[model samples]
Target: MKTVYGPYRSWRLGYALGVDPICRQPKVCNLKCVYCRLGCGGIMVTERGRFVDEDRVKEEAKEILDKEKVDVLEFRGTGEPFLAKNLHEIVRALRGLTDVPFGIVTNGTMLGRDDVRKELKDFDVIVVKLDAVDEDGFRRTNRPHHSITFERTLAAIRDTIAESKGDVIIQVMFYKGNVALADRISELVRDIGPSKVFLSTPQCPEIPGLSKKELTDLVELFSGMDVRTIYTECAKER
Candidate 1:
C-alpha cells in the first residue's frame, strides 16, 4: 500500500493529504475503540517500532507535494501514528521537503512519554482523541490496551496541550455510550484548554450517531471556546 494518500477534504482540516506511518495489513494499533471505523481486527501493540521506510515515505511525499497542493500534511492511517518509532524521523524528513504545515491525528496514548511530546512539538497541528471522562466510560468507548489507563491518557492530553507550540485540538466522538457524560467531558475540555474542540460522532452504520438537535444542545457547554461539530459542518456544505 502507498504510504502517501489522499488530498481529501476533511470537515476539520480542509483539503488534507495523509501520510500512513503504520502501513501494515490488518492494521496495527494500541486501542480497539468500540466505535472505530476500522473495526476490531488488528494487532494491539504498546511498543513503538519502525513500521515503514522513511526514505520511501519521503519519496512518495515529494512526488505528491510537487504535483498537488494540500492544506495540511496529516500523519494518520490504519493504526495509531505514535506506534511508529521512526515517526519523528519521518516528520523531520518530510518537513524539509514541503512548506505545507504538518498535522497528526493521534489517540494520545503515547503523549505520556517525554520523547513523544518533544517530537510532537515539531508539528504545526495536533488533533488528539478524548472520547470519555471516567474510567468506565473510557473503557466502554475506547477499549484500549491492557497497559493503558484513563488517568494516564487524560494527564498526557493535559500536558500535551500545556506544552504544545502548535494548535492542539481535542476531538470528542460522542455516541450512545458517552453522550450522558457530555457535561463532564466539556469540563475536562475546558480544563485542558486546547486550541479548539471538534465534536463528532461515528459515521459507521454499526455505531449510531446523535441527532442534529442533540448535538446542537452541546454547543453551550463549550461556550467561549472554538468549537466545531459534524452536524454543523454538514449543514454548511449543503
Candidate 2:
C-alpha cells in the first residue's frame, strides 16, 4: 500500500499531501464514528503499535517532495494516525525532506498520553475531532472504544490544546446525531480555546449532511473564536 498519497485541494489546508502511518488493510482505528467516510468494519484497538515502516514512509515522502508542491504534509489516511507508534520517527525523518509545514488530523483519543502529545507538538497544525460534548452524543456520533470515555476524551483535547506549541485546531462535524449539542460543544471548545475551530457536516454520500442554513446558525455560536465552515470554504474555493 502507498504510504504517501495526495496533494489534494483540502478545504482546510489547501493542497495537502497525505501520509498514512497506519497503511493497513481493513483499517485500524479506535473509533467507529457514524459519519466516518471509511464506513463500518475495521480493526478497533486502543493500543499503540508500529504498523508501517518509518524508513519506507520517508522514502516515499522524499520521492513526492522532490517532484511535487503541497501546502502541508498531513498525517491522516484510512484510520487514526496516533495509533502508529513510530509516528514521531516518520515526522522527524520527513521534516528533513521538505520545508512545507506538517499537520495531522486526529480524533484526540491519544492526546492524553505524554508521548503522543510530544509527537503532536512537532506538527505545525494539529486538527482534532470534537464532535460531541456529552457521553450520549459522543457514543451516538463517535462510538469510541469501550475504554474511552467522553469525559476523558474531552479533557485530553483540552489539555493538548493548552499545552501544544503548534496550532491546535478543533474540527467538529455537525449532523442530526449531535446537532442539538452545538451550544454545549461550542462552550467546551471556547473553554479549551484552540487556535481555530472547523465546523463541518459529513461530506460522505451515506450520511446526510446539514443544510447551509443549519451550518450558518452553528457558526454564529462560536462567535469569538477563529471559525471556518465547510460551506464557506467551498464557496471560497469556487
Candidate 3:
C-alpha cells in the first residue's frame, strides 16, 4: 500500500502531500481519542520502533512529488509520526528527494522527550493537539496512555512552543465533554503563546459540538488571541 496518500484539501495547511510513517494494519497511536477519525479502537502504543522503512518512504514521496502539485509535505500518519523511532531520518531523506515545505500534525504526547522536540523543530509548521487542560478532561477525551499524565503533555506543549523554531498551531477539539473548558483552555492558550489556535469539532465518529451560537461565542472568547475556527476556513471557501 502507498504510505503517502493525499494532497487532500486541508483548510489549515493548504494543498499538501500526506505521509504515513506507521505500518500497522489497524495502525497504532498513543491516544485513543474519542473523536479520532480512526475511531476509539485506537491503542496507546508508545514503543519506539521503525514502523516503516525510510528508503521506501522516500521512494513513495518521490513518486507523489513527481505527479502532484502540492504546496507542502504533511506528515500525518495513521498513527503518531513521533512514535516512529527514525522520523527525523525519514524527514531528512524526503528533503533530499523533494524541496516541498514540511509540516506535521502530532498528538504532542512524544514531545515530552527532548530529542523529539529537537527533531520536530526542523519542520516548517507544527500542529499540536491540546484537547484538555486537566487530567479528568484528558482521560475522558483523549484516553491517553496510562503512563502519560495531562501535566506532562501540557508541560511538553508549553515547553515545545516556548522554544519551537517553526510556526506552532495548537489545535483544541471542542466536543460536548470539554466545551465548558473553552475559557480555561483560552487561559492556558494565553499562557503558552502559540502562533495560532485552531478550534474544531469532531469531523469523524460524529460527536456533538457547540452550536452555531456557542461556536461564535467561543471564537469571540479568543478574539484577542490569533484564533480561527475550522468552519471559518470553510466559510471563506464558500
Candidate 4:
C-alpha cells in the first residue's frame, strides 16, 4: 500500500497537495468511534510508537513539498500524531523544510500533557475533535479505550487551549443517535476559545448515523459563534 496518497477531498481544510504524516498508536485512546475508516473493532492501544520511520517521513515530506504545491500539511492518519515519541522533532523538521503552514487534525486526547501541548504550539493550525459534549454521549459515540475518561479528554482540550499559540479549530461531527448537548457544547467552545468551530457531518459513514436536518439546525444554532460549515457538496461524497 502506498504510505501516502491524497490531495484528496477535504471540505474544511482545502486541498492537500502533499504527504501528510500520521502516527503509530503508542498510547491508549478514549474513543472507539464507530465511524473510523480503518474499521478497527475498537479503540485500544493495540500498537505503539511511531510506526513509520520518522526519518523516512521527514525525507518524504521534504521531497513532496519540493515537488508539489501543498495548501496545508495535515497530521492525521491511522492513529494520533502526538503519540509519536519524536513528535516535537518531527514538528521542527517539518517547519524547517517548508514555508506552507502545517496543521494537525487530532482527537485532543493527549493535549493535557505539558510536553504534548507545548509541542503542538509550534504548528500553524490545530484542529481538535470533540464529537459529543457529555460523558454519556462521548461513551456511546466514541466507544473509547477503558483508560480514557470523559473528564480527562475534556481537561486536555481546556488545558491545550490555554497554552496554545496557534490557530485552534474545533471539529464537531453531527450524526444520528447522538444526543448532542447544544448548550454544553457551546460552553465547551467558549472554554477552549478557539479561533473558530466547524459543524459538519462525517465525510464517511458515522457510527451513530448521519442527519442532514440536525446538522443544518446545528449550523444555525451556532451561527453566533465564529464557525463555518463544510460545503454540503464536498461532504456528500466522503
TM-score of each: 0.94, 0.94, 0.92, 0.83
What lDDT tens digits, residue by residue, belong to model 4 across residues 3-74? 344555566666663333443333234456756655645346623355466577777777766777767777
Candidate 3 lDDT for residue 100:
69
Q: What TM-score number comes out for model 3? A: 0.92
Clashes of 4: 6
Residues 71-160, candidate 3: write the lDDT tens digits.
Answer: 888888778888889889899899887776898989888898877977976699999999888899999998888998999988888888
Q: What C-alpha lDDT do the candidate models reach, one value each?
A: 0.88, 0.87, 0.82, 0.67
lDDT of 1 by residue, 62-94 (tens): 998888988888888889999999998898889
Off by over 4 Å in 1: 234-238
**Candidate 2, which segments miss by more than 4 Å at Cα?**
235-238
Model 1 scores worst on lDDT over the 10 consecutive residues at 229-238
Worst 10-residue lDDT window, candidate 3 = 229-238
For every candidate in turn, the CA RMSD to the true structure comes to 2.3, 2.2, 2.6, 3.2
Best of the two (1, 3) by lDDT: 1
Q: Record all residue pairs in model 3 with backbone atoms less than 3 Å apart, i.e. clashing.
A: none
lDDT-wise, the better of 3 and 4 is 3
Count of clashes in candidate 1: 0
lDDT of 2: 0.87
